[model samples]
Target: MGEFFETYRPQLIYALIVVLSVLLLRFLTNLLYKWLLKQELKKYPNEKPKAVNWVKRILNALWLVLGVIALSSLIVNEDKYDILKHNFKLILYLGILSIVTIVGAASANLWFRVSINRKIQNAEDPTSFKFLRYIAVFGIYITGILFALLAFPSLEGIAKTALGGAGVIALIAGVASQEALSNLVGGVFIISFKPFIIGDIIKVTDTMVGTVVDITLRHTVIRNFENKMIVIPNAIINKEKLVNYNLGELKICERIEIGVAYDSNIDLAKKIMQEEAQKHPLILDNRSPTDILNGNPVVRVSVTSLNDSSVTIRAWAWARNYSEAFDMRCELLEAIKKRFDNEGIEIPFPYRTVVLKKEKETHKNHDAGQTAE
Candidate 1:
C-alpha cells in the first residue's frame, strides 16, 4: 500500500484536500453569515447595515471560485489536462467575469451611499440628482464589464482584428447617419447649454410660448398656458430660432391700432395715449416713446383706406411683463374709447361708393335677354 501510494500520493492528497476544503469552507462561511451577521443584520434593517451581509456573501462566493479552481488544477496534471490545458483562455475569461461580479456586488452599497450623498450635498433637485446618479452608477458597471471583456487575452486578439475595419465601417455609418448623429449631439448640446431649464417660459420664432418642462438629450418639453405639452426636437431647436423668456430683460413691446376722425386733433390723441400709458404702474417710462409720423411709403398704419371720417394710427408701448403689457393694452383701449367719445374723434370703418347705375344696367340686361328669347 505504501509503494502504491508513493506513485500518485501527492496528486491524490492535493485533490482530496482541495475538495474537502472547498466543501467545508463553503458550509462554514454560510453558517457563519446566517448565524452571526444575518441575524444581527435582520434586526438592524438599514441598507448600509445590510450591506455587510452582502459583503460576506461575496467573500464566500469568491472563496468558492478559488476553491473550484484549485480542485480542478489538482485533479489533472498541467500538461495532460484535457480541458485545463486546451481551454486556458476560457478559464481566464471566466475568472475575470467572476472577479468583476464580485467587485460590483461588494461595492454596490458603497456606490449607492456615496452617490446619494453627493447628490444631496450638491443641493440640486433631489429627484433629478438621484436619477442621474443612479444612471451614472449603472454606467460605471457597464463600462467595467466592457473593460473586462477587452482585458481577456483571447478576446483582445480577436477584438484587435475586428478593429482593423472599424474605421471604415464607422466612416460609412457616419456619412449615412450624419443628420441623426447631429441630432444626437445636438441633444447633448441642449442639455449642456441650458438654453432653458425646466419651468422657464420660452418662445421660439414668435410662434411658440410655454414653460420649459424638460430638456432631454434629443428633445425639449414645454407646457404652454393651455396646459398642453409641446415636444420639440433638439435638432430643430438648435437649427432654427429660439428665445428663452427667462433670460430676456423682462420687457416686451405691445402694439395697439387706433384711428381718429380726420378732423379730430391728432396731436391730442397722441398725448392722451401717451398719458394713459405713463399712468400704468408696470409701464417702463425710463425711455422716451415716439409718436406716429406721416408720409411713410410702407405704412404700418397708414391712411389705409381713407375712411370718409378718420385716419388710422397704430400706437406701441413697451412694458415690463407680458401679463402687464397685455393688461395695459386693454386699459389703454378703454382710455382711448373714453377720449374719442369725449372729443368726438371718429374711428371710422371702411366705406365704398355703390353707384345706382348698377341696378339699372342689370334691368337692361334682363330686358335684352327677354328680347333674345
Candidate 2:
C-alpha cells in the first residue's frame, strides 16, 4: 500500500486540486447568480427574471465543462497536457463569446420590455418597439457568431473566404427567399409608418374584421370577434387597403336608420329617435364648443329618404369607441321601436294588391253582353 501511494501520489494530488477548484468555482457562480436574480427582481417585480435564469443555466453548463476538462487533464500524458494548455486560450475565447451573446440578447429583450412599458404609460405607439426587439436579438446572435469565427485562426481563413463571395451568396439567398425578404421589408414599412398598433380594431378585407393582437417579423396576428386568431402576411397586409377605427380619433358615429309609415307623424318619429339615442349611457357628446354654444341637438335626426310605403329617418349617434357605438346602436334600435309603438308611430311594411284573372275576364264578358243588349 505504501508503494502504491508513492507511485500514484502525483495523480491523487492533481485530482484533489481539480475537485477543490471545481467546488470553489461552483460556489462563486451560485453566489453571483443569486445576486443577479435578486437585483432583477428588485428592478422588475412584475416581470419574470428570465435573463438571470439564462445566466444561471449558462454558468452551470460552463462549470460542468470546466470540471470535465480538469478531470480529464489528470489522466492525460505530458504531451496531451501540452496540447490542452496550448488550446486553452481558444476554449476560453469561445466560452466568453457564448456568455457575451446570451447576456447581450437578454439585455436587448429587457430594454424592449422597458420601452414598451414606458410607451403604454405615455399612451404612445408601441408597434415599432415590439418589432425592433426581434431585430435587436437577431443582430446580437449574428455578431456573436462573427466574433467566434474570428477567434480561431483556421476559422478566420474560412471567414475571409466567405466574405469574399458574400455578394454572390447574398444574391442566391435573396432569390431563394424573395417572399421572406418582401415580408421583412413590409414589416419595416409598417413599423416606420404607423398604420395600426396592437389593440386597434381594423378591417383588412370585407370578411376580416379584427383587433391587431401581435405584429411579428413576417406576419400580423389579429383576434377576430369569434376569438380566433387570423395570421396575415405582412406583405399582403401592407398592400391591402385597411380601415382602422382606432386611428386618429377613437370616437365613432353610428348611423341608425328606421323607416316609419308615411301616414305616421314624421316629426314625432324623429323626436323619439333623438330622445332614445340621447338617453343611452354610451352615447358621446362630440359637439364642439361653438356647436354647443349654438345649442345643437345631442343626437341629430334627419329625413334621409321617402320610400313608397315609409319614410326613412337617420339618427347620427356618437360614441367614444367602436364597441360602445355598436352597443349603443343596438340598444337604441330596440328602445326606439318600443317608443314608436307606444307613441302610435307606425313602422310600415310592404303592401301589394292582387286581383283574380278569372274574375277580371268574367267582368269583361258581362260588360260585352250588356253592350250587345
Candidate 3:
C-alpha cells in the first residue's frame, strides 16, 4: 500500500486539487447568490426578485462550468489520464448545457409566473395564466434541448437529417391531427380575446346553460345546472354563438310577467308589479343607459299583451347576476300575487261561454208555426 501511494502521489494530488477547487467554487457561488438575492429583496420590497434569483442560478451554473474547464486544464498535463484529457471537454460541455438548460427553463417559468401575478392581478381566469406558463416552459426547454444536442457532432448530423424530412412529417401530422390543431388554435384565440373567463355563466344553446369550470388547450368543461360536466371542444366553442351573462357587467335585466282580469285597473296593476320588483331583495338598484333613455324607473312595468280573457303585464327589473335575477323574478311574482289579492285586483282564469242553439231553434220554429196558423 505504501509503494502504491508513493507511485500515485502526483495523480492523487491532482485529484485532490480538482475536488477542493469544485467545493470552493460551489461555496462562493452560494454565498454570492444569497448576497445578491438579499440586496435585490431589500431594494425592491414590493416587486418580486425572481429575475435576480434566476440570474444567481445561471451564475452558479457558469461557475460550475468554469470549475470543470479549470480541472480539465489542470489534468491535461498528466500523461496517465489521457482519456480524461481528450474526452473531458466534451463531457463538461454537455454537463454545462444540461445545467444551463434546466436553470434557464426554471427561470423562465418563474418569470412568467411573476409576470402573470403582476399583470393579471385578481383575474378570474387562472386557466389562461397556467396555459401560457406551460407553453413558455415548453418553448424554453425545447430550445435549450436543441442547443444541448448540438454540443455533440453525432447529434448535429441527426438533427440535420430530421430537419431535411421535417416538412413532409409536419404536413402529414397537420393533416392527421387537423381537429386537434384547430382546437389548439381556438384555445389561443379564446385566451387572447377573452370572450369568457372561468366562473362565468354561459349559454351555448337553449339546453346547454352552465358555468365555465375549466378551459384547456383542446376542450372546455362546463358545469350545468344539474351539476353535470359538459366537455366541449374548443373549436366548436369558437364556431358556435354563445351568450356570456357575466361578460360585461354582472347585472342582468329580468322580466316578470303577470296576467290580470280585463276589468282590473291596468295602471294599478302596473304600479303593483313595479312595487313588488322594487321590494325584492335580489333586485339591483343600478339603472343602465337604456333605462335612462326610456325614462325607466327603478322597476319598469308595461302592458306587453292582451289575451282572450286577461291582460299581460310585463315588469322589467335588474339583478346582480343570473341566480339573483331568477330569484328576484320568482319572489316578485309571489309578492305581486299577494298584493293583487289584497287590492281586489282579480287574476282571471280561462273560461268559455256556451249557448243552447237547439233549444233556441225549437222555440223559433214553434213561434213561426203559431204565426202561420
Candidate whose lDDT is highest: 2
Between candidates 1 and 2, the one scoring higher on TM-score is: 2
Off by over 4 Å in 2: 74-91, 149-176, 205-214, 221-232, 259-268, 278-312, 343-373
TM for candidate 1 is 0.49
In model 3, the runs with Cα more than 4 Å from the true position are: 36-91, 120-134, 152-180, 192-194, 197-233, 246-251, 257-272, 279-314, 319-327, 330-373
lDDT (tens digit, per residue) of candidate 2 on 54-120: 7777776777676677778877898899777656666766777888899999899889979988998
17-59, model 3: which lDDT tens digit per residue?
8778877877887887789678757855665666556656665
After superposition, the stretches of candidate 1 with alpha carbons farther than 4 Å from their true spots are: 1-180, 191-200, 259-265, 288-310, 334-343, 350-361, 366-373
CA shift at 172, candidate 2, in angstroms?
11
TM-score of each: 0.49, 0.74, 0.56
Better candidate by lDDT, 1 or 3? 3
TM match of model 2 to true structure: 0.74
How many residue pairs clash in all the candidates, one count each? 1, 0, 0
| lDDT tens per residue, model 1, 32-61 | 767856654574445444544654666577
Q: What is the lDDT of residue 227 in candidate 2?
A: 95
Worst 10 residues of 1 by lDDT: 295-304
State the local distance difference test value for candidate 2. 0.86
| Whole-model lDDT values for every prediction | 0.63, 0.86, 0.77
